[model samples]
Target: MTGKLDAAFGFHETALRLRSERQGVLASNIANADTPNYKARDFDFARALQQATGSADPAAAAATPAPALARTAPAHIATGAAGTLVAGNAPLLYRTGTQGGVDGNSVDMEVERNAFTDNAVRYEASVTLINTQIKNMLTAIQG
Candidate 1:
């Protein structure tokens, strides 16, 4: 079934998705560094990927405890924990710059640059791993 395919491919797919999402979040933060009252947002890559791939059945939780068919809406929909989404993992607070800017933006250029670099490195590493896995799979199939 589709669930099985998701479970099998989830690792690579989830990592790629998280990497892309993180890039967007980081870029946004960097772009808004000078904007007043702009709070940075990011995703918890590890937690989100774990949650997405950990379950055997992607929709199992949602399907369970079925409600009445006639009900307009279910009282509660199965939801992942808070801060588990792509943008909930951003640092809640950043230290105000010693030489604070008049705009009240606290994003330090050096810090954001370092963080972005590190994320890029990690993303590359994940891509390498996935590529190696694919190559190995191909070799096995050919043999």
Candidate 2:
């Protein structure tokens, strides 16, 4: 039954999880906009989703390689580009070409705001897709 549901929902489930994880990274970037030397970080959604869903496409797999980060100590937590615990295998890339602040902070409010809004929209879409699939499955079961 678990496998049946997994097959039914397909990649949207993984996409929803990745989107939620990315929201945390984006939110952390916005929250630390003023923190000195704080570099804004984000992952390629398409690439992450492909990897998470275990795509066999070589081109997509090579497009974005997930770099493994090692924890120096057991108590040390894995931190994202913004020093937040963004748990996932998605590669966190630093935002480039943005004007760095005099204090060395790399977060641009405009960019962060735009990314956050975009991610939120995508997340909602994923949730809606999953809900639709569930409703269709329930209807089939009843009928």
Candidate 3:
């Protein structure tokens, strides 16, 4: 039964989790826009999702070793390969600056805003999908 449920909701479950995590990263980028030397960080959602779903070719996966996000402190969460969470490590990639600032901050308000909004919409959509699936399951059980 648990396996069946996992199979039913696996994709959306992973997607929703990744979306929420990405939302946090985007928010952090926005919050640190004014901070000097702050590099905007993000991850490849499609690639992460692909990795999480175990659909990637083994050769490709082996070729790319998981890279860690730059951490300011020793206690920060360690990031690694996409879609595989090992002790809170999420794969984070630094965003390249479109326009360099005097203070060396890489965050662009326009880009962050757009990405934030898009991630939020996708998150909401994932929630809606999960809800619909649950409702359908309940209806079937009742019938």
Which one is best on lDDT?
3
Per-residue alpha-carbon lDDT of candidate 2 for residues 60-108, written as tens digits (9 for 90 to 100):
5568555556677989876544242233455678888358699999999
lDDT of 1 by residue, 1-143 (tens): 68964666677777777777777767777998889976556555665565556643447445532233233367756433432245322222334454555676766777667778888998898888878877887898799
**lDDT score, candidate 1, position 103:** 73
lDDT winner between 1 and 2, please give it. 2
lDDT of 1 at 2: 83
Best by TM-score: 3
Q: 1-143 in candidate 3: lDDT tens per residue?
A: 99999999988888888888889889999999999999999888887888878876779877877753566698977644334342124357789989999999999999999999999998998899899999999999999
Cα deviation of 119, candidate 1, in Å: 1.3
In model 2, where do residues sit more than 4 Å from their true spots?
56-88
Query: What's the lDDT of the predicted structure labeled candidate 2?
Result: 0.78
Q: In candidate 1, which residue pairs clash? A: none
Clashes of 2: 0
RMSD of each: 8.3, 3.9, 4.3
lDDT minimum window of 10 residues, candidate 2: 80-89
TM-score of each: 0.62, 0.78, 0.83
Q: 141, model 2: CA deviation in Å?
A: 1.9
Q: Can you rank all candidates by TM-score, best first?
A: 3, 2, 1
